[model samples]
Target: MSALTAPHLNRWLIRLHRPALFVWTVVLLGLGSALMCLWGPLADASAEAWQQHYACAPTGPCLYDQAAILRYKHIYDYATMAVLAVPFLVAAWTGAALIGRELEQRTAQLAWTQGLTPTRWLLSKLTLPAALVTAGTGLLVLLHHGMWWASEGRIGSAKSWYDPPTFYAGGPITVALALAGLFAGAFAGVLLRRSLAALGAAVVAVGALWAGVHQALPHLWTPVTGVSSLESDLPVGNGVDVSTGLLTADGERLPDPFCGSTINPQCERLYDRLGAVSWYHDYHPLSHYWPLQLTASAIVLAVAALLALAAFRVTAVRTRGLS
Candidate 1:
């Protein structure tokens, strides 16, 4: 028993220290650093713009610019996409290589004969890669937080940071999803025994899973809502008027008028004649975010585990036949 366990532990250690793992670490750190550096400049620009248009007073006539908020939203959307793509690509590449190459090169036979238990062997193979992925993703989350902090106080009239899907960004859910993809890819390699084919299968499988889960599930566990206060000239008398809204403790929308021409023809005819209008809107979730993410990831991981177990059984059977 001791001998068997020793060999298994050694294999795990060797796999963990592989060059590929180091490369993954470096790549993630580099990407995170680059993104973090960009936050300062973006925040500065946003702050400068805010100072120009909006008055920061304790109590007075204040307005939110919808157009500027939209512009920021657009920029953040693209930035987030680029940030997320890195983890997904890394997970896919690493996962495909995890078990695929071993089977392709027929190395599993020798490794099994070296007195390693199948469970330990499989765990060893997965441990380092999984850790690497988790660490990288954690760094990404940190970078996201930094950017969020930098932009927080600056954007007064903008939408809620959580409004855009990009703002949901990469969190625990995303890390779990990427890890599930890796597991699925590795399982594909076990079943297919060909690197390229396993990679293709993994891609298709993950894509389908992501699409299905995202569509079927709504924001329940992770409530993603965008809240923004916009102050624009309400169209009154061939011109625009200004308005504002308030939110109740229960998140109910309440309008509060500040100033506007009541007698203006456009204000009476088009602007609802309520002067400046203030109101709040709430976006309710159709479903939970965390539970669905977890469930979907679990399903993929279960499938991967089953596939690995099947591969182990097949290999053991073949060994017995030769004996």
Candidate 2:
């Protein structure tokens, strides 16, 4: 195929792979939609209601409380895992079959004889899937941003776009990580010439890289640190229960119904008296989001590219025997 036809061929390849991709996409969309719907109701419900509904007793209010659930750390965690992991996993499997299946089935020689360059072949295989993954991740990022903004005061303690959760949670870093895995898996397939074994190796390597970087690098670089507090009124028998809005580092507290209430003597007395004040110190990826994400992604990409190059160098057409 001519240079102008390369994109068409890539699209064709994607079309051919649509069955698997569609299944994976449906699974991802289902997971994301479920979380999006569930988190909202959970956030709006009272702490006691949430505990009773979920059938778990938290030490204090559950993190699903409106103020806490909207936090960037938690939001990004769920969104990113849902949006990125499925595509990456699917791509890794597809990539592992890129060359290994051809070699295993003795089709490499026929393609080589047809004058298809290895570089063009590999590029064609990588570009379409990578683009699909990037687009999906971008959508997920936008969704998280919209949700965070809508939550208003609830998201006061959430990480910002520059936060690590945002970086690793489902954005450019996720796309890059998936691309890296694709390339690495493709390279392993070329080297191993066995689809299953290559796939196993690729999965292990990708998992290790993702987990290791996420766990070890956050502390080594800039970390997110902040304070959050919540206060609520306790009710006596048959009395009204009052709750205060959460307070954050900015010292802005939400409007509480019990504030300045004089009619209820007990409520007024409790207001004057010291109430239950809960404070917590949380570490999120607020500062080092981009730098660490970029650095890690680049490292993985570089390794993958080098492996692909090595595979290209070693690949040879077998005239009378299997590759």
Compared with the true structure, all predictions reach lDDT values of 0.56, 0.54
Query: What RMSD, rounded to one decimal, does every model reach?
Result: 10.1, 13.0
Looking at model 1, residue 135 earns an lDDT score of 76
lDDT of 1 at 10: 56
Question: In candidate 2, which residue ranges exceed 4 Å CA deviation?
Answer: 1-8, 31-80, 145-167, 219-285, 316-323
Q: Write candidate 1's Cα lDDT for 1-323 as tens digits.
A: 23346446556556744776677667677766655654666556566667755665768766545455556656666656756665356445644567777768866545666676555566666776677776777677667656766776776644344343433454454565566666766666666778888788777766676666555444323334334433333321110112235434456554644433435555334334333233333332323434544665565556556644665565455455432
TM-scores, each model vs. reference: 0.60, 0.57
Which parts of model 1 have CA positions greater than 4 angstroms off? 1-19, 38-41, 53-79, 156-168, 219-282, 285-323
Task: Evaluate model 2: give its lDDT.
Answer: 0.54
Candidate 1 has what TM-score? Answer: 0.60
